[model samples]
Target: MNKRLLSTSFLAIVACLLWATPFAAIKIGLKYTTPLNFAGIRFFISGLLILPFIPKFKAKLRGLSSKSWKLIIQVALLQTTFLYGLFYTGIDYLPGALGAMLIGAQPLFAAILAHLMMKNDKMTWTKISAILLGMLGVCIISLGRADFVLTTTIPLGVGILILNNIVGSMGNVIVARDTQEIPPRILASFSMILGGIMLILVSIPLEQPNWTIHPSEYYFALGWLAIVSAMAITIWFGLLGRKGVKVSNLNTWKFIIPIFGACISWLILPNESPDFISILGMLVIAFSLLMLNYFNKKRIKQ
Candidate 1:
């Protein structure tokens, strides 16, 4: 394999692991602060941290068309506002691992949306089957208990999270196609700043009047999100730049994030243990991801 491809693959794996832990972090942080406030502070810190680095980042943004800027805004809204908001809120009701699994459906949504929206991308039966298997896995994991119907709120939250994933997948397609002309670093930085600003503005009305971080644990969570999550995004886009968006989509292995998130939840929160069906669901998800990678590789070769 090429050195760049190898390095990008490694980075993608690391990013997935870092992201997986975020649900636990968010769950912990929520104890100290409201979701909107927590998300706002984290984004602000991340946006500011990248400021100095932004000047050194290189990618062509000299003559972006108005259409491109509009697309970037759309990407920011989908990724930052709708997606993150739903995710954070969902974590309040569901285990992080479960949340991750729910969001794991992104690649499936991406494949479907890409087929409809993009000219180059097409949906194949293999992709459709992979999506179906993945969705079945998620259902097994998420709703396979005798008291399954008892977790009504969780399903609602997961529904929003799924929508978040769909929007994110759509944004990924946009970034993949458009960012080819723009610099990844520049685009990442700008998107973060824009998204951060939007969150701050949104939080003004939706969040508590006097925001405060209660426990010191909140700070740790914030730090984890700012450094790990934000940095991973930068790294993700960088990898995307070197490889195409399709190649970068492989980063969805971070889908295991929900699994890690759920494990942490079982330890820290009052979450129930996974039943056999849920465990089976988890296996199905893993298998689906493996198949996705295999099919993606085969498609590339063909």
Candidate 2:
């Protein structure tokens, strides 16, 4: 691969890994704080932390049209504030395995949204099969952990998570569009900061959260997550904006998150063990990824 592709791959892989392990932190942080407010505090601090370092970021903001600002705000609303709000709240009420399964649905939604919105990313049967395999692998992995309970009953939590996936997917599609107007870093910073403010606004009336109740570990988790968010968000925006990149292709890498989540859970939490079934699920996920990326690329060469 070319250097640019190599760099993007490295960044994308690491970013997904970072994104993968954070659900534990969010779950832990929620024990001491309300979901919405905790998310707001974490993302708001993330935006603050990211904004100052890039001096060139401000120069890129000049002369942006009103429409561009609107687009950025829409991204912020859907991607950060609304998406995370539903996510944190929904996960709070569901079993962890089920929640992971639902969250794993995001790439499917993203791929569908990309197919609908971006002509260049039209779906093929191969991509569809890959999506299914990846999702099934996730289900198997979660099931191995005793967290996967298939049910048709749509509870409030499931409803919220469904909406969360849709909104998050749409936001990703929006980001993937080639507007060529806003710089990626500036866009990332604005959406995060603004969306975070919106989350805080909602939290005040609905959650009225107590920020002071948590011990030092809570803050440590929150801080680590904030830093990860800063890195991941910026890298994602950069990747999405890169020429010739597809939203679906990048989102598929998110399947790796479950592998990390399962492993990390076994390490961090008591009673969680690495079982043979989960290991099998991990292998299936790897094969699915190879079919999606490697074989797909090789097919083009033929």
Candidate 3:
């Protein structure tokens, strides 16, 4: 493989690994800190980590048109603030594995949104089938859990999580379509900084001034979220720029995140194993990802 392809593949794998660990780490960390606080800290750390690299970011912010700024703001809100806020809050209520599984439906949402919003992108039967399969898988996983029966309260949490996925997927499509005009590195860095600021402002009212690091485990979890999850996303955007959005979508292999999180939860945390239906759901999601790749390739050839 060429160097670009090799680097792209490696970055994709790294993104997946970092993403998978977030659920487990968050689950552990939530034991000590509030979701809002955790998210704020994660973003802060991520911002600090990337500060040194800011000089390398090539986008000419001053020269950007108002339209571009609008696009960037929209993306930051949908992809960063709304999605991450809802996701972290949902994680407070659900297991890390389940949260990941639910978010795995994002690509399906992206496919749909892309077809609707982008004239160049059309939804094929193959894409539809893959999406359906993934959706079914999520249903199976949810249904199989003995406690999965509809509780009015849990549904609220799940609904928020689902919304997070939808917004995130839409953001991805928007970013992909717009990358021709906006440099991904500039977009990613600015979005992170803006999103971090937003999260901190929001958290000020929601979270107390308890900046206490009560446990060493909390510190570890924060470190992982900051260095791994947040920074990994920045790296992901860079890869997306180099590889193209469709190729970057292949990073959904990070769907393995929930599976890995689930396994760790079962082994290390006091989390329960998913039922047979949940296992089926995971398989369905995996199959859907394969179909997405297949159809995406077929469309390119046509």
Candidate 4:
């Protein structure tokens, strides 16, 4: 049990770290193309990248059940299409710091939804407290990086991001609950491809994107983003399908994303640097994870 816990935790951190590095890459890619268009291309390549790794991909694709296909389509729509669509729109209305902060709140929403939706994932006081602590850490980190100014659009952005979190949580719970028979890679591959196509179709009418050649930098960013999506998302889906994994507890690790993201920004972006508050926020997040794990182990022992 302990070994499984440690292994899952390690993979969770890895997945979150991969997720953390992509913000800058997305920003870089956006410089060369529209948001939905770039995202569509990135995810399409991500799905294709995974295809080569699965043994007998053609047979597996043909063998998937109608229920599996339905699950895949549902996940594709909620997780990738709606989630990213709202994500880009929300970010447009807020500062990057505020956007990151809101995005970081996903785990909180996940926890609450899991408690309501899954009998085994009921919310305990310790769990709630720990998640709240992580949220506080997210806020501290965001505030440290930039000023939070209130504008008229703030409410709209916050609402959209809240919806984004809820939709994403719904997708996570569905996978954890309903995808035991499906291989992780298959689920991720099909969902991302379908979702990518859906995004591109919508982008054509709305974004009016020009199909033009992009610079090497843009391709580099797109490649990295696709690779990250393919690897990290597969790891995540695997984790979700593992026995004894709770959607809420698994999602708590996402708190590290903003911390790692801040560190990455400081390293790569000239305008960014580590500050006292950010370090303090990192410490708080570290403590929160400790609290979460401590409580989890105690519960298991009983």
Return the candidate ranking by TM-score, descending.
4, 2, 3, 1
lDDT of each: 0.68, 0.85, 0.68, 0.91
Encode model 3's per-residue lDDT on 1-302: one tens digit a residue.
Answer: 67765565566766776776676687788788667766766776776677566664544666678888888788778777788899877755665446545776676667667778767556667756766676666556645553433444577777888888778877877776776576665677667667777877788788763666478888887887888845677777766555345522443455555555455566666557656766776787778777777766776799
lDDT accuracy of residue 243 in candidate 2: 85
Per-prediction TM-score to the true structure, in the order listed: 0.78, 0.92, 0.79, 0.96
Clashes of 3: 2
For candidate 1, lDDT tens digit of each residue in 1-302?
Answer: 67775575577767776776676687788777667767767876776676577553433455667776776677678767777777767765766447645666776777777777777667777767766777777667555632333466787777778777777877777776666766665666667767767876787888753565377787887888888757777777676556444532453465555555556556766766756876787788788778877977887899
So what's the TM-score on candidate 3?
Answer: 0.79
lDDT score at residue 232, model 3, on the 0-100 scale: 77
TM-score of model 1 (CA atoms): 0.78
Q: Tens-digit lDDT track for model 2 on 1-302?
A: 67875576677888888888787787689889888888888888888888887677656677678988999899989989989988878887788778878998888999988999999887888888888898998999877766545555448788899899999989988988944577787788888899999999899999988856678889889999899999899889888988878888889888888888788888988988888988888888888888988756786699
Backbone clash pairs for candidate 1 read 20-257, 59-183, 97-258, 97-261, 97-262, 100-258
**Which ranges of candidate 2 are over 4 A from the true structure?**
1-5, 148-153, 211-213, 299-302
Candidate 2: residue pairs that collide: none
**True-vs-predicted CA distance for residue 12, candidate 1, Å:** 2.8
Highest TM-score scorer: 4
Task: Report the number of clashing residue pairs per model.
Answer: 6, 0, 2, 0
